[model samples]
Target: MGIHLHKLALVGAIALGAFGLAACGSGSSDSEGGATGVENPTPVGGSWEKGNFLPVSTFTDRCVSPRSGTDPITGSAYADVLGTRQDENNWLRSMSNELYLWYDEIEDKDPARFDSSLTYFEELRTFALTPSGREKDRFHFTEPTNEWLSQSESGIYIGYGVQWALISSEPPRKALVAYLDQEDSSLPDAITRGAEVISVDGVDLANGSDVDTLNEGMWPAKSGESHEFKILPLGASDPVTVTLVSAEVESDPVQHVKVETTDSDRKVGYMLFNDHIAKAEGELIDAITELESEGIDDLILDLRYNGGGYLDIAAELAYMIAGDNSVGQSFEHMQFNDQHPEINPVTGAPLDPTPFHTSALGLADDSLKGYPLPTLNLPRLFVLTSGNTCSASEAIINGLRGVDVEVIQIGETTCGKPYGFYPLDNCGTTYFTIQFSGANAKGFGEYSDGFVPNGPFGTEADLPGCEVDDDFDHLLGDVNEARFAAALNYIEGGDCGDVAVKAFAEFGTSNRLLESNVSVPKEISRSNRIMVR
Candidate 1:
């Protein structure tokens, strides 16, 4: 049988939201009762006995019968399945067996933490090949509940509906409401952006002992969980206590899109792209078409908070930005494990590099079918970023650079992740293991430590363009906002003058330690991901 392409639609809770499957050919094995006389080998202990290990095992049943037991401490019945501690060793072995890169580097971990499945998973990833000390291969997780996966894929969440930032780590730790999800109209008007979080669950934030309580209140596991918070409004001196109940919230990925005329008579298109979901593609196309009609001189893509989503959308966006200049060029190259260098493990076919997509995929109907992508066709592009910019968002920068397009990056370094996976649902939990590493047309994919700003950080190499700290004082999209101002200044042929290079010192070591001690929450803070399908 001929190999057919299969797309994997894995959605991350935090960063890159969606991913498209690579050009992998899927075909039946001759040994599986096909015309060929070759016999198929049996799988043992999650290891493949014959043929290509990855794709073959991926499609075949490779899992061994899990051991069962009872938890001594909790007296709960447990099965040694995918999410149990008894399967820790097998899980690690399986990850090492299939991970695209760094599999050989995984160290043997102790299985004693089997009582705590999440901790065991963490220990399993401790040996990942982290060249720059910043863990890029550290997204392996088991959700407390399966609903999180569906919620993430649908761009709906259950939380307080506020994105917060730890503003200070001094004696009195301070957190500020960075932004609010307006779609969650259930939130009180007093809980607007820039509001100060004074206390959570009656635990004063100034007290060092309250960190644990604060984190729990902020990231509750279930919807309808209520937490009492004392917040100081943006301009208020008195504090008001409010009990906020978590609820399911729908998000709008394209927060803002407009055409702005700079002081120098340049018609610039600005788009605040926050998430990469199904909805974003149409929004982006509409924005681009509008800008093209307005005869815009340049475009500014604000992805400072975009965690990433949908590789196809990323390619589409790149095509819209570069237009004809990108045709006939490789958009991205997916590199699977060493065993399958030229073949797609998922499809069992010769690997074909992904090219710049000219048309939208996965649309409901002909509304966007064969719609010609609008392009800025500018030689250079300005992208505003922060540590949160990741995955498919980075793909945009890398894909553009591969085609010799100038990408002027401003703000902080990105959460360097060039790896992606097809999320696997085993038992009751979703597992994300790096299955492929991506490269641009130029074959440059060595950004594991992350893409640094203007200068290099440790082993991470510096990217093209200057770096500037985020101006938190000014609202995002404002002309005076430090990052935006820096981009605008560069557009006007000016330089960032005397901009202080300050580290984001919100979460101190103690606070970080406290956070780690807590149980891993179902919701993730950053969605560092690449989804296929």
Candidate 2:
């Protein structure tokens, strides 16, 4: 929603004040922050430059673009915010109300115009109070106000607290500008004063030769001549200096395979996926291609470290893996300005500006569908999952599972963020919403309830001696355990009864899989049961 003309005039000043409030105490304050009333100094703004803001014309041109260039995966419900609307005035009104409420909560000290910022507490009231009252409760709007109030409050209270503590002075009407002055980068310089430094040689691990390297280490940063730094520990509990005679720099040494051929010829592949896909995608594709060429039979995609980014690339990769099964299967669909579609009501002209709307994979002819990759036709797959696998990566898992590929999930349950979002750049900031819910085999969306693994995999606690993150490794590798023996037996062309018997011998009769599989009465002990039972 665009800002209302009535509100736009005051937005700039209000924004500056809000920034001031948010910047206090931390931009330069002590790490633990001194007792509230300590005299403090201002922060020194670093030489680092801010990025350029996208021009308003950029949005205008996009709004007029007939190509439908919005992200397809984000779905269509957001189309209302992206396209022109007949009720343009009403949309602006809602946007203005939200902005006013925000400004009032953070910067408006005049209590006459409104109640406490906390007054906008009740979900029923805050969301329900929108001018239209129509979009109320459409989206959950339950962000806690306490934290926002603390973070957004004018630093006046804290600044006064500090001064009073130091000099027993009264609380000043305004925040002591001395402590929060950010025009010059002074505070950071103070915090980092007297940090230690050392010198070391840089040598390549692959070739035992000294090499010139870029040395960009974390603070206590100082202005000094560049030197080859062997190891720079910025915030280690105990900083140790080591002179570098030989340095080791190599690519992340995680590999994937299509099958665990060394162990009973079970087809399996390994993948150690990370969130920063830009640095890993090229190598990831090469690794996958290598596995296919090697005639491996199964796969294990390890995504424990994947945080998420550039979902388009993730989508493209999913198409490579499961595209054939997922094509025509809808991932998510969006609706552009669903409520009122045409000329503006205020001016009786073209909708001044259009906003987009979005939704999940509902039954609609034009619903944007996901194109899945062709199946690998493997009997079973092992997936090394963890909390870090989120966003685009989760989409891949969800898309693949929707195709009925039996995934033996390992490690911890993955981060449950199945809803999709497109960066909705409005004003000077970006707000992302749950624009679309990802659908499964039956076109049922999966956002709130996440994908649970098949069996108990990794524990929350880290194992001793093993790399802490290797819980993901254990999940992927532990499939050779008795827990998976039953699934493996079935895969090896055994009867379901035999597989169940094998699973029972290893995991015991009271095991969950055995209980779930058996329907007949417990007539005989396991030793006397038929092998094929």
Candidate 3:
């Protein structure tokens, strides 16, 4: 998905690690300790407690480092002021007080106390817990506007064209190629899926003490940066030394589109969708058009590594899948804070249902805005997931289910996120504070603990499907792969794969694997919940 990262608007403040339904570790730790108590309501015409007197506009666009030139992506001149860092902090506090979904729960601390706007912004989330005692708000984060804008320049990021699956982050740590960037073909052919990183820049990958060197080489700082790696290709006996030159890489959301014939002679389409970026609209339209032409009986939408992007794109994809069933239904009923129960806090529009988009709303290309989307007219959809399946990706599952389109989840539980935000840029930093919580048509979207597989199904509680571990040995889209095979088997006769593997893939094992998984980059780690206004 492209905040401008696509997921937070495509990628805004949702910076965090990647794993199965595990708790996303964010930098909101400074907000803990509860020393700052909750804010009390103010009289109708008066100010609230704890310095909540001023409006967010008083500090808007006031940055410590103001820009004077035109922005390359937006092609608009910046309107920044030579203001102090405290101005930025005041902006975050006032803005949070106005638009945050949990404004009342937040501890109203002083904006002038913290030196940096980042540390101050982190303290703006609620300290409330879920029914399970988990933190209610886990998606608060921020990134420099310059860094985010650079990626937005062309929806490109500089890297080795590899999405590494951190099977183990610590020693004897194991990192495998989850998948290669389908958008980049310049990467060496030897660096295919399942390839193992034995060493990075001569530093041993597994059990390497210098994580900094390994990380630097694994994720190059800039384009044209050269890094060496001793990689053991998939199924190879020995490792081979290769140089990985970083380049400006863009992610391809729709990849590995294939139509498979089952034993019953039924046609099933498998589309590995990785992001909800704008371009993905065209890519997905093309993919669905092909599948629809073939008259496929079923669709397996793989969203294992998807972190979400444009919500509109997600709605379009849902319409493409469910067709008339969700044509006029509420894709999501979004609600903001109590102060503005009937109006969207961010857009200031009267609160209304986000309809399951019938025609393309053109996120990728303005030319395709009103074009009708091609649909498989599927009654049931199969999803391949992992912890990486998040936000906009989760929205697909929830939205489809809202219209009673059967979703058979075939993998670990998803990253439960029923919240979305419009990435708001203030004074050189884009903040991703939770602005709204969404519910499906049946009034269900409280999945903060994620959707569990094998839980009581048909109740919108937990999704129904086979629970299996991710098989990295075989390439994705391969029917023999654990999750894919399970999906195929389920379609054949509702058969779930090996009991032993299913048992092993449950709670304890999933958590253990997640605990060892790799931490992603701050800028690129998080997917988006893009409010594309």
My TM-score estimates for the predictions, one after another, are 0.77, 0.39, 0.87
lDDT of 2 by residue, 84-147 (tens): 2111212222232232222122221221122221221221122333232333222211122222
Q: Give one digit per residue, the lDDT tens place, for model 1 in 1-533.
A: 11011222111210110001111111111112212232332323343232222232232221222223542212454332222223333443444455436555555544433444344445545354566555556555444223534444545676777766655544456667756655335677778756778888987775557555776687564688999999998768899999998888656666557677878998887877776765577778888888789988888898777767667778889998998899889999999768667766554557788889887764423467677778878777888877667778888888888998888887767767787765543323345567788899999877766666676554324665577765545555667667777777777775545554332422111123223211112233135454444
TM-score of 3: 0.87
For 345-368, candidate 3 gives per-residue lDDT tens digits of 565567888888888876656788
True lDDT of residue 187, candidate 3: 75
Error of 2 at 457 (Å): 16
Ranking the candidates on lDDT from highest down gives 3, 1, 2
In order of TM-score, best first, we have 3, 1, 2
Q: Give Cα-based local distance difference scores for all models.
A: 0.60, 0.30, 0.71
Better of 1 and 3 by TM-score: 3
